[model samples]
Target: MSMNKEGRPTAAGAVTAIRTAALLPDEPLLFEIGDREHSGVDLPEVEIGEDRLGGFGRRTSLDLAGLTEPEAMRHYVRLSRLNMSIDAGMYPLGSCTMKHNPRLNERMARLPGFADVHPLQPVSTVQGALAVMQQLSDWLMTLTNTAAVALSPKAGAHGELLGMMAIKAAQEARGEGHRRVVLVPESAHGTNPATAAFLGYSVRSIDARADGTVDVEAVKAALGPDVAGIMLTNPNTCGLFEPQVIEIADAVHAAGGFFYCDGANFNAIMGVVRPGDLGIDAMHINLHKTFSTPHGGGGPGAGPVVLSEALAPFAPLPFLRRNGDGLELVEHVEGEALGRITAFHGQMGMYVRALTYMLSHGGDGLAQAAKDAVLNANYIKARLEGTFSAPFGGQPCMHEVLFDDSFLEGTGVTTLDFAKALIDEGFHPMTMYFPLVVHGAMLIEPTESESLQTLDRFCDVMLELASAARAGDAERFTAAPHAAPRRRLDETRAARQPVLKWEEAEGRAEAAE
Candidate 1:
């Protein structure tokens, strides 16, 4: 690989325009320094005639790049600086709650009891860890007011699959396995329909009302005996709460169906609304989103699905248990419990972090966090409504505010252009063109963590962009993000023609240069 002038890896195939090197000391592909007799570390003395790999290996030379220790360290350190991480600044991506992850939680997660435990350790030796699990479960039960919880799911989408599996198992046990239609609101998260459909259920979309909330009558009309369930997201993708959630749940249950609430938005209503009391049969709580756990690279998330009394019996197995004086985890063959979803206990690190966040923020603090999340969104809405167009302007939203491109009609600025322009203003862009119900949707969620001053500054930048759009400055909008580390890219081409590998060859650097 050749270091392009822009400091990115350059290859020969599908080459773009060549430019003079802008970044200094641009290195060539690592293969350029490979040698037959070079090695970085000393190897121990061993017999060369030993039959390793059963004589099926060593097809070619194990050539690798050689570099000094300092060069390697500096290379990685410089690359790390190029990344935009939550540790660097505020991450304002909507629908993804990126909040402040306390350093205390990190410290707790790294403790030997949590970080050094093996998945296959003896249950007796790991009783303390199991107790941690049990305690977390008790808190989850108390917080959601639910009967039971299954803690094996890996993430929000994986948890949705588990909730649907429980519903299916319950239906099969009742000899009503033919029910296969899942009613999903149009404004629900995209994964809701995909999860239901993947489980062989027909997805029927229900259009939201003009106010961005689900219409109770529409849901009632859609209910039938074949309905498996209704998957909905309260404080929906449009950031509006479905006030008729209880009625919708009742209608679905009356029709012999369960209610699967996508709890990804739980951060906006935690400790304020207990989903169990709201008639929800099952819901998944994204621990990473609401509890300030570090969201790894799209993974290592814990989504524990809480079940109502009616559905608790069908929860997954291998849950934590507490005896009179000791703690234990039930992982063996049990009676009629759904089998384990993961190989061992769920992500212990995430659990510890989530618990630490919850214990630090008691009941009132959580409620206030919910309240502040809503207040911040409304503040943004109120500040930007005059400049931008709100699709549903009359009522207050929950945690995020949705804007469409109606105000830019004659000015010709699109939602994508406006979002790209935010990158130039030293902020990550909001979610754009999602929730497909609203045209040119821009969903911005400023969690409870943002200060009033920061929010005002963001609003000022948004207003300036809105003014530019209103003044028909479409050229400036189209070529946006001029101040970012990189300029605007052809996203469509990048997605369609993905370059996913690196191979070593000669003349790669010269051709790229």
Candidate 2:
């Protein structure tokens, strides 16, 4: 409706226009933009007279849309640009440890000998690859000061399962298989409880103390003949090292229960501390997190479980062992082993990359990486001390800092709101509402990857946002990410009304928009 002479507002529901410059442009799905008959490259047509699939054959069209080579290249390149990657900037995703993955690791991982070897190749033929695995295991064993390392768990959660399985196997060997409970701390990684439950162990929650560390007395009270083990994370989700961890470990041992340390926070203490020294029975070290391989894409990860002497015998199969002249892959489960957790001998690319990081850093360098990680996190805590609310304030944190939404209480701003606004300021949001213990948790882990200048810039932006929220600038946050490649989304609605297929409502892809 055009404005009248009075220039009063009309019934026109005209939406405010967003500038194209502020948008990352809609990238149509291949199914939406490509022709089904189009081919990126021409090929000679060869018609098969006989069906090799026996009775099984394609009865319907695949309905795959094809694009030209340039179009396909451009599509992926556009998608990559829209991503928030560590290589693009500092990724301070607490607990996840989004630190810099050195290019040296990548180059080593891509070497012909490491990258080209197949798992099924003859043991003699893949000596170099096997040597890489052996070197990585040796480094992990040395770093953690553990008895053995299971190098085939594939990822962190898988490694957790392996660790617990080893615990169960050891218990059963000692005729104590009746143990059926796994104590999980509230501040531990969520996977701890899930892994315990998945393995048929009843999960008992041990509450965190006022300071965010696990309650030791709670562990003692929960201990019994039925207790299998306690899963704990040192330098826990709250980013504070458990000062009473040794006491907790001893108590659990006295009660005939093993201790499984969630090594997710190992980045903070890799060189300075060792889990074996703390009496940990089994722990899974994420090669991607501590040793610095490219992390978090749902693929190409390694979580080799370091085992104590008690649990070492039960370590999983497909591990590397020295065979006099060369390294050998123990493909079959021997003694009290947990058998095979994965189909192959683990992620080879991750092994090479992790080893490269170790060789490049050496012992002292790895320790300093841990030190710098803690320093960076503490730096963040110090900078945002009064501005943002630290859940466990006035204490030096590990590799990450935990902040709550208390500062935004009266400002009508939320943790999520503040995070969305951060995106507009050219940064990926910190991990929010996690560890569940804190009300509106914002966990930031700068790792050792970030420079001093980057941390200062990030702190400046955080302070400005905090000040704005306190000044009753709720609209600024509520309507945030106004200048991001995309805009804020109603995540709940998207989850509830998910359009999984490309054929669904034509514009469903733009639901976030």
Best by lDDT: 2
Q: Report the lDDT tens digits of candidate 2 across residue range 1-513.
A: 222334332233223232335346556566555555534443556898988898899897767655555556666877677888888887788899888888888888778888788878889999888888888888899999999999898789999999999899989988999999999999999999999999999999998988898878989999999999999988899999999999999999999999999999999998899889999999999988987887767238789899999988887777777899998887765353567888888898998888888889889999999999999999999989888888787779999999999989989998899999988888889999998999999999999989999999999999999999998889999999888666888899999999677763564345335
Q: Report how far off residue 363 is in candidate 1 (Å).
A: 1.3
lDDT by residue (tens digit), candidate 1, 307-391: 9988898888786766777877777765674798888778888888888888888888888888898899899999999878898
Can you tell me which runs of candidate 1 are displaced by over 4 Å?
Answer: 1-53, 62-73, 335-337, 505-511
RMSD of 2: 8.4
For all candidates in order, the CA lDDT equals: 0.82, 0.85
Q: What is candidate 1's TM-score against the reference?
A: 0.90
Error of 2 at 462 (Å): 0.5
TM-score per candidate, chains pooled: 0.90, 0.92
CA shift of 429, model 1, Å: 0.8
